[model samples]
Target: MPTVNDVEWDLVGISEIRWMLGGLSRQRTNVIANTKGFPDPIAELEMGKVWLRRDVEAWIRDNRPELLENKKGPTPE
Candidate 1:
């Protein structure tokens, strides 16, 4: 049987998609319209911008270059 290592991270299955959408499901950009602002949390976590598909985390890391070059720990004011 295939394990986690065998599955490509980018080839998300229906079950994987459902799990990822769980967080997006609760977000309410406009509750009146039954609207949702999906991917916002991921954007917030990554930086002010969100990562598109394809490069995924690499795209986010590139967008927030400081995060990559940081010295770790908190910065001094």
Candidate 2:
């Protein structure tokens, strides 16, 4: 099994998700985040919630392919 250090990490929070979803409003992002098919957050932290970037990207790829097609540039870190 992969150890913690061996695993690649690309975690994202609400703001990042907003950007990934093409600058969606916070309310819209929250709604989508709570949607039934959305990926469960990997953790809920003091700041907010976080998800694996890969998982969010996958969900976007499947559900909102047009967003990816119109991506302005690389996602911010």
Candidate 3:
């Protein structure tokens, strides 16, 4: 299996996605997840849903670029 750093490892679960989005509330996360063009999950595991970081990043960039401006983290290259 590939390591996180080896691969883009953009695939992430709901909680991780929430954290990436600055720790959004569960309700808000649900709302955002259901929004159109929010990117379909790569897999639906028992733990929760997963999404491609690239897809989510694209959505955020196209819909809410402002969020990126305030974010503080090592953004994917």
Candidate 4:
């Protein structure tokens, strides 16, 4: 069995999630993040909340499959 140390967690923050969801506005991202079906954040720190990348991706897969197409990089700031 794999130990916790053996696992690699790909964590993400609000900005990263904003990028994942096709560069939604910060307000929109906050709305989506707080939606009932959205995954609960894995941790919260001084910088902000952080989530598991896979969880966010899974939510996208189920809720916003269209965004995945042509998903290459984050939108410019």
Candidate 5:
């Protein structure tokens, strides 16, 4: 939850995204990932893709505002 010296940003993969969206299933996460204009992942590793937490959260705020209503602050742990 710490962004050291503003260089180490938080990242979120499918698991974190799912957890953020209330335990969404993998398929659901895929659907969201495939959505047009969904933020492009900052990195794609062997496990899957990873997105900057801020990018993902902003996308959610703009595209799915409801998701952010109950969430705590800009980033949720």
Candidate 6:
């Protein structure tokens, strides 16, 4: 609730309320994260999307690390 944008912006934000209520747990993080105004709205909702559930990047990292590699280490300009 109290995001990096809130403490410096809104006077009394939802974060304060959560703090007053003895702090929210990690499980509740998703509840608020999916609500609105998160850092990345698209990525936030992607967690709930069935099609975007799995991490393709992780899949690539584990199964296809070769796909991403910086072969060119240095260059003399």
Q: What is candidate 2's local distance difference test score?
A: 0.92
Question: TM-score of each candidate?
Answer: 0.23, 0.84, 0.73, 0.80, 0.76, 0.24
| TM-score for predicted model 1 compared with the true structure | 0.23
Worst 10 residues of 3 by lDDT: 1-10
As for lDDT, the candidate ahead, 2 or 6, is 2
- lDDT agreement with native, every candidate: 0.35, 0.92, 0.79, 0.87, 0.82, 0.37
Put down candidate 6 lDDT per residue, 1-77, tens digits, no spaces. Answer: 44565433322233442332246664564455454433222222323421111233343345445544533355668
Residues 1-77 of candidate 4 have per-residue lDDT tens digits of: 33569656798998999999888898899999999999998778999998888889999999998898667567779
Evaluate residue 68 in candidate 1 and report its C-alpha lDDT on the 0 to 100 scale: 44
Instruction: Write the residue-wise lDDT of candidate 3 on 1-77 in tens digits.
Output: 44566657568777877876778987788788988878887678888888778878888888877788887566789
Give candidate 1 regions above 4 Å deviation. 1-7, 10-54, 71-77
What's the TM for model 2? Answer: 0.84
Best by TM-score: 2
Q: Ranking under TM-score, best-scoring first? A: 2, 4, 5, 3, 6, 1
| Model 4 C-alpha lDDT versus the unseen true structure | 0.87
Clash number for model 2? 0
Candidate 4: segments with Cα more than 4 A from true spot: 1-7, 72-77
Give the higher-lDDT candidate: 4 or 5.
4
TM-score between model 3 and native:
0.73
Q: Model 4 residue 55 lDDT? A: 86
Candidate 6 is scored at a TM of 0.24
